[model samples]
Target: MKLYHHPLSGHSHRVHLFLSLVGVQHELVEVDLVNGSHKKPEFLALNRFGQVPVLADGGTIISDSNAILVYVAKKLKLTDWLPESPAGAAEVQKWLSVAAGQIAYGPAAARLNTVFNASFRADEVIARAHDILAVIEGVLAERTFITGSTPTIADVALYSYVARAPEGNVDLQGYTKVRAWLKRIEALSGFVEFRKTPVGIAD
Candidate 1:
């Protein structure tokens, strides 16, 4: 399997964390987002949206971080990664939803905007981002991991973006429980670190 990704992408980090946890071996092919290499034909064939975190399993191609998580979890027969039974699977999907939906628009994108000065729908996007964080805090308070007693793809999906929130000037200071959960995820065996996106002037 080959995983196409950027080292600094939170979305990519989520997949990396899962691969490590599951003891899955794969090659990493860096996607040069800065140069827009993801838009080229070779990458577009793997992901029509030209996104990082694309995976090639045998001849199969998978995109979107959450979708990749599901595909990997299912392929590995790691029920803990995605669980079985209708309710358990839906609960897993809920965290994946938070990862792809809220994390993308909120903390992750906010960090890109406020730190890197990327063009975004600033006020509208960030307001909604903060709203998402508020809900996430509530979820964090009830559990060590996002969706369950044990860490799963949900936790992997959420951890990186929230862990690096302050870099975007999105203060995580008030989310004590969430912050604790972050530390817990970091302490796991075989856990690799997620780097703070390079610090820079807010443009």
Candidate 2:
């Protein structure tokens, strides 16, 4: 398998982290986003949206970070990563939705504004970050993982951006539960750390 990605991309990091956790032997193909390589025709052919973190497994191709997580978990028959029960599946999907919506526009977008100079209202994105963190903190106060006791794709989907929220100037200081949750994911076996951007003007 080959993962086309950018190291600093949280979306890319989530997929890479899951593959590592599952001990899936794969190759990393870095997309040169700095030079607009993702916008090129060849790369666009892989994902018409021209995004990083596209997975190529033989003839199968998967895009979107959460989608990639679901695909890999199902393919590996990792029931722990994705539950079979309808209720459990719904719980996991709920957080995955938060990862795509709140997490994306909040922490992820804030990080993009700072780290990549992407135009976004920092205050607004940071506010959204806190709003979602509050909800996550409340849920995590009584559980070990986002969905339940065992880790799931929901945890993976939310990990990278939340872990690096500080880089976006969205402080994680107040959410004790969220901080603890991040540490738990870090301590997991086979866990791979996301590359930290050096503190710069973004700080």
Candidate 3:
């Protein structure tokens, strides 16, 4: 397997962290988003969406971070990650939704604004992010991981971006439950962290 990733991209970070946590060994192929490599013809042909974290699993090419999580987990028979039963499966999908929604809008969007000079209105986005953060804080106060006591794809799905939320000017300072949850995820075995620039996913 080969993973195409950008160091600063939290979406890519989710895939990287999941692979490491589950001890899935793969060759890392860095995609230099900074240099417009993802937008090039070759990459565009591989993934019409031109997104980071395009995973090549033998002859199969999978794009999108959450999609990669499902594919890899299912391929490896990681039933715990994707689950098999109805409630357990729905629980997994629930937090994946959070990954694409609140977590994306909060930490991911904020990271873009700070690091990429992204066109979003900063204050508004941050406030909306904080509102979501408050809900997460309340939810986390009652549980260790997002889905339940043990870590699942839900935890792995949202960990990277939210773990690095401060970079986006979203405060983790006031959310004690969130802070505790961060520590919980980090304490897990084989948890590789997200990297930034000139490393991890280099050109």
Q: Ten-residue segment with the worst summed lDDT in candidate 2?
A: 194-203
In order, candidate lDDTs are 0.82, 0.93, 0.84
Candidate 1: residue 73 Cα off by (Å): 0.7
Top model by lDDT, which number?
Answer: 2
| Residue-level lDDT tens digits of model 1 in 133-165 | 788788877877878689888888898888887
* Superposed model 1: Cα runs more than 4 Å off: 198-203
- Decoy 1 TM-score against native: 0.91
Can you list the residue pairs that collide in candidate 1?
Answer: none
Q: Compose the digit string of candidate 3's lDDT tens values, residues 8-106.
A: 888888899899989999888999888899999999988999888899988999999999999999999998777888999998898899889887877
CA RMSD per model (angstroms): 2.4, 1.5, 3.9
Error of 3 at 5 (Å): 0.2
lDDT of 1 at 135: 87
Q: What does the lDDT read for residue 167 in candidate 1?
A: 67
- Which model, 2 or 3, shows the larger TM-score? 2
Q: How many residue pairs clash in model 2? A: 0
Q: How far is 24's C-alpha from truth in model 1 (Å)?
A: 1.0
Ranking by lDDT: 2, 3, 1
Worst 10 residues of 3 by lDDT: 194-203
